[model samples]
Target: MISVGGYYCSGRSNGHHLQGVAMVISNRLQSSVVEFTPVDECIMVMRLKLAFGFMSLIVVYAPTDVCKLDVKEMLHAKVASVLDRCPQRDICVVLGDFNVVSGCDRAGYEMSVGPHGSGADAGSKNRLLFRDFARSQKLRISGSWYQRPNPLRWMWYSDVGNAAKKIDHILVSTRWRILQNCRVYRSAVVPIINWLWLPSGSISKLPSGPMITLGCFPWTG
Candidate 1:
């Protein structure tokens, strides 16, 4: 919970400190926070009081693609339950590392995925599951709707630095066009993906508000 200029909320597994997810809200926006709930080790929900309406931020870190089918199904079910509990009028956002390769195919999933996704693992099991979940929930995969450089496209790398893949995603309610731009910053020091949103007006430190940029970076202990 080391957020220099913000408030940090994290959820960790009982014996696994590295297997969890966290969220950080800027100090300026701290007063708008309504409640924070750690659904489990891998999922967290934060509600905020915004100018226009309420907002729900569901941050998650799903299991790897190699995990068992039941495990992946359970994760998606939990996430879906969380979304269902949120108010229908609130601006809902789900973002984090899904650890599933979402390939560059927008034929059947045009409403969920966009045209600017990477061309790897086109119809992987995890990819289909992810896309189907998005479609079922009527959420748009906002991160894949932009064209970025090759370096900025991948979010994870292999131990030997020989392979890389894009496993991070930002899903927003399809009814709202709040996502302005999404970018992945792969740094040698700090690896983070930033999902920018310009909802209506400006905030204290961000460009626009109601909902601002949410950075779901990993904080190792």
Candidate 2:
């Protein structure tokens, strides 16, 4: 069984339009969902009760690099607001299609991003903002820390241009030394393009266990 969550386009009298963000949770994990909130069409936050404490998961679909600067700023502000409200002790994990590339620049940002990023630098303001946000939150981009093959690292591929980019990401709070491994999950038969796996582990000998496996696919339709 699968539990899906997201914002659905409202049906109007003129026509039915559906352009929104969504997340699916398996039945085994559904029981842990404490609450979920839809911040807007582009963002959603879900909380889950763990064995020892709680965890906050934020899912976002940011505007593309071509969008107006104000639009991108507004979205980030909204996301930050939601993040501020989360409990300080809760393990926070942010994941989604950020539409921004962190690249392989792991100079001063060694704490936030890693060296396994892909694609050329488009010099997008969104990318800068995302990096700054991660730094401010003390969150580490989990996928970037590990080295993977080119095809496995890139989350978005342009068929027309024959280009691939690593725009999707999974971030975890630095305080929790819980993320054991993170990588893109690819399969010939599955429709899911990006998947993150976090194995169960104890935190500070507190037995704060919750093995979270998340899969995300870009909404093309």
lDDT of each: 0.74, 0.70
Off by over 4 Å in 1: 1-5, 12-18, 121-123, 187-211
Candidate 2 runs further than 4 Å off: 1-17, 188-202, 205-210, 218-221
Query: How many residue-pair clashes does candidate 2 contain?
Result: 0
Model 1 / residue 47 / CA error / Å: 0.8
User: What are the models' TM-scores?
Assistant: 0.84, 0.82
lDDT of model 1, residue 93: 85
lDDT of 2 by residue, 110-146 (tens): 8998777655555766788888888888988887787
Give RMSD (Å) of candidate 1 vs. truth.
4.1
Q: Backbone clashes per model, in order?
A: 0, 0
Q: How does candidate 2 fare on TM-score?
A: 0.82
> What pairs collide in candidate 2?
none
